[model samples]
Target: MKRMIVRMTLPLLIVCLAFSSFSASARAASEEKYWDHWIERHAQPLDASNASNKDLRFLKKVLKGKRIVQLGETTHGAGEINATKVRMIKYLHEELGYDVLAFESGFPDTNASYLNMDQLTPKSTMKNSIYAVWHTEDVVELFDYMKEQKEKGDPLILTGFDIQSMKNSFNVAATQWVKAVDPEKAELLSQSENDFSTLVTDSNTFDEFSQKKEKLVKNYQKLIKFTKTHASELKENLPKEPKAYEMFMHSLQLRIDVMETYMLEEMKEKLEEYPENIEDFSFFMRDRMMAEQFQWVADTLYPKKKIIVWGHNYHLRKQNTKMIKDWVQLNGPNMGDYLPERLKKQTYTIGIYAYSGASLDSSDNKTVKPVTSPPPSGSLEALLKAADRPAVFVDFLHTKNKKGTSWMYTPRTALYWGYMEEQMILKEQYDGVIWLEHITPSVIIK
Candidate 1:
């Protein structure tokens, strides 16, 4: 009787153990099912080499009839990422007929230089048009490509939408605008030149402006009054034969207005103990200004033309992901948030991600290299690699009937400026993602 009981118990225990193992395997497969289906079945491999037209057909199909395509980078300066951007620009221009290439740069710094590209060599224009950090081999290649296109008489519209001007290009352009229209009132523009100069310094300029906030406000007011008073004359002086000058001035004034609004918001935030609201307000305003400028470019400057904007993933995302969601909860609705509202289905955004790479650290005057560590468990990067692909493009927006993707609502890892966020909402923030298994740092031009 004892031997029969033991034999029955041993068999039952073995059966139970087998069932437990199977259950665990099923759970593991379920955990990875969504990412696996997307990457393995749906995602396309992308070759970023300039000579490869292999992916162009796939890219064109994805971007078909889209008026505005905003392609974002994981970092500001990465060699493969920038090369990919340039390649996309070339493809979109040649295949899809995209003519405008909007950039994330100061308006007064890059616009006039690009518009007047004929007067300057590509090398000179690049050095003068953008900040020193962007002076890379990759960027130089892009500039040379633009110059070549311009020479072909199919000139691309190159413009910037940032406002970090070290030289007070706004003041220079503002003074020129007034001089062109109303020379007598041009002297009045110099009334705030000293204050502008104070804001123009390279060292701790934002801090300096905060200290003299009232003076900056007053200067903004003075410029506002001058422009409004001579609005008619300024409009009259605008050249009709070639409207680039008018476009440049209009953009300059718009940037000045945006900066003034930002400063005012910054001053108001000074009253709060935790001024997270200030940064949020600044971000919203800056993005709004960028969207406004792009709308102007689309409507007035080049009607019905397709445009592609290249910038950091944070700025280009359609939804405000974990990047801005700090202790301050209500941070965004960012630039990407505003742009898609206006463009609707016309806007298509692609965010780039790298699993591991070296990031550029330029915080100190000295440029150093920082190695990016691999993502933690259950992170987006980890899931992307589960597909066993070196590079992948997942079009979340275009894919239909995708199952079990609700997991994307949960946070995933995102890296920006040598900082990593472990809770970025990957799918909600972008229409698609371009994932690279490994990345290299952008070559800094001495």
Candidate 2:
């Protein structure tokens, strides 16, 4: 009986091993074929040396008729990606007539940027308005180019859609609000400003800001009431500059809202013994604000003109299933996640990828360093690198070869904030992709 049982088990084990080997071989073959087909059919090689007329023509064909083109980078501080983005911006502007450069900086500060780009140098404008990481040579060059274009009768607008306005804008807006309506409240508002300013100045983190919870909420309520009371008069006074007035008020409101939102969350964290899900709440608030700003720019400000958006991939991706599911433990959405509902087919998101190279470690203040790890297997980056192209733009959303897109919805690697998440759905997240063979860090132009 023992001999018979052993003999049967050995045969069964052999059969199982054979099946496993066959399945592995089949999967490998299928993956290889997928890469080859995508490269052959959809990938458009880009010229690295110069913006050849042919290169511009190809990009125009890809971007033609798109009302909003969002360009995303794998990392925040990669110079090579920014350089490529600058190239794309020029092509989109000159050839495709994209008029607005919507950035991921502070909303209030962008007003400073647009007003000063013509009167000031790129460096000065950037330092005054844009984020620190964006103060690069390539960004400065972009500003200079935009300024030249505006001077030649083709006006280009510089705007931002983020909520991280610096302290100066907060003080200015509050002072204006007080002086305009109730001068008696000037001292009260100044005290609030000084309190907030002291917190920001004394510490790098939001600990102090969070500690002054009641003050933030009180200020926000005050501003909201003030805006409501003077809404009609303010709108009437700026007939020719209604958009400017709208933007100013919106910025002020958003700054207070964001600060108060954080402070509330901080209180909740401190109060709760076991905190409830705030991931969705926090993420939704920020992204929702950004989406509102973008909608304002596209629908309210420039309905007829195309806009070019620059930001990190996570912020720009149309779908954020993995992030929402993992972070919030629910199916919440993000900036691109919300925008598509309002903008529909007009929204086009392009995610940039790289096989391997160095990027600035934003976690540290460290400069250029190699990637933390190689592209994981079965990732979008791996598949793109397998295509054997140095530089290529693959339009997954509108590709004629639908077979190439079959693998897109699969969760893949997304490098964000000096870390990697290996579950981002490519096809759902972005409309297209720009794959670079190598990467380099952005230069700190101090």
Candidate 3:
């Protein structure tokens, strides 16, 4: 009698285990279906030349009342991401009222491009001011569109917020502006420009910059002094371009602050036997300054206009902490994280990610290689792909709290710089995400 009872109980236990597995699978399918309902499947990532805004009409509601929209990419070398950004930028400028398009590039260089847009060709303006990583055919098309719009009486302003100097545009623009106002004072600026240019072109790393810290600091100080002393004359001479002069002064001061911060971090690294949080010191300073520079653009430069920010995902995400190498902690707050409360309330961040295929790896900006891989199991990219869409935009901010979308609130793996997986809560990091089923290398223009 005891053996018969045990046999019947074992069968009952097996049936219960089978039912549990089936129920879990059913829940997962239900969750995926829920995500599918919120996914905008009609949108396509097209460049300005090929885009039609009918599919993008959805953005009007998504970005309503948002003064600044930051567009982020997984890497700098994805062709689809660049094309998608150009299309969105065109939509923002034409359909919406966003007039300023800011980049993650040199402040002075990009402004110089804007001031001289009529004199310089679109391609030349892009190459001279924007960073080389963005020197792609897609961006050139967008530049062409900007010029076209300018010719038609509507203008889209181009600017940047980075502290690092780019090319020789800053040096040329600074000296020329001073000469036009006060010829005698131009000599002092020219000398500082010469020194600063050497520091910009010669140094590509922290150690190199550290070696020239004293000279770098001195040059910026002298430049700042000249700008302050002759502010009246400079503004008076350029009545039509008063904002230009103001921004130039702001750039000089911001650059010096950034350099000083770097120098202090370097000093600590050298003096301390064990620097506890030295690994991310420069990144912290850079991101903080970038945020401040962006704020200046919004509040001071284009106070009444909506703005678009173009940058990498790592720099634009809202979260402050991340784990590197699965052990080491990264506590550096990104540019988005450092944004002021006022701006944060009106900002919408969108991150670009790919499900599979090769991304161009131009880490050194010299030789390009391909990083080919598929999304790992249980990654955000994988989950999006499971929705069975070639391309989609998930509006996490609006849908994450809905029933069956609880998966978005939990930590999940996502591809980051160099296609490495990092775990983050999707809804917390970005307002929305553009996911591509496959991506190819960006067309690098020579």
The Cα local distance difference test for each model comes to 0.67, 0.69, 0.74
- Sort by TM-score, best first: 3, 2, 1
In model 1, pairs of residues that clash are: none
- Consecutive 10-residue window with the lowest summed lDDT within model 3: 322-331
RMSD of every candidate to native, in Å, equals: 9.7, 7.0, 8.1
Best candidate (score: TM-score): 3
How many residue pairs clash per model? 0, 1, 0
lDDT sort, best first? 3, 2, 1
lDDT of 3 by residue, 90-109 (tens): 88998998988999998988
Give the poorly placed runs of model 2, Cα more than 4 Å off: 1-31, 169-242, 270-275, 278-284, 322-332, 367-369, 372-374, 400-405, 409-411, 417-421
How far is 204's C-alpha from truth in model 2 (Å)? 15
lDDT of 1 by residue, 251-343 (tens): 536545744675445545554323455435765677777767666776677667898888777778876634535212554666766654657
Lowest lDDT 10-mer window, candidate 1? Answer: 196-205
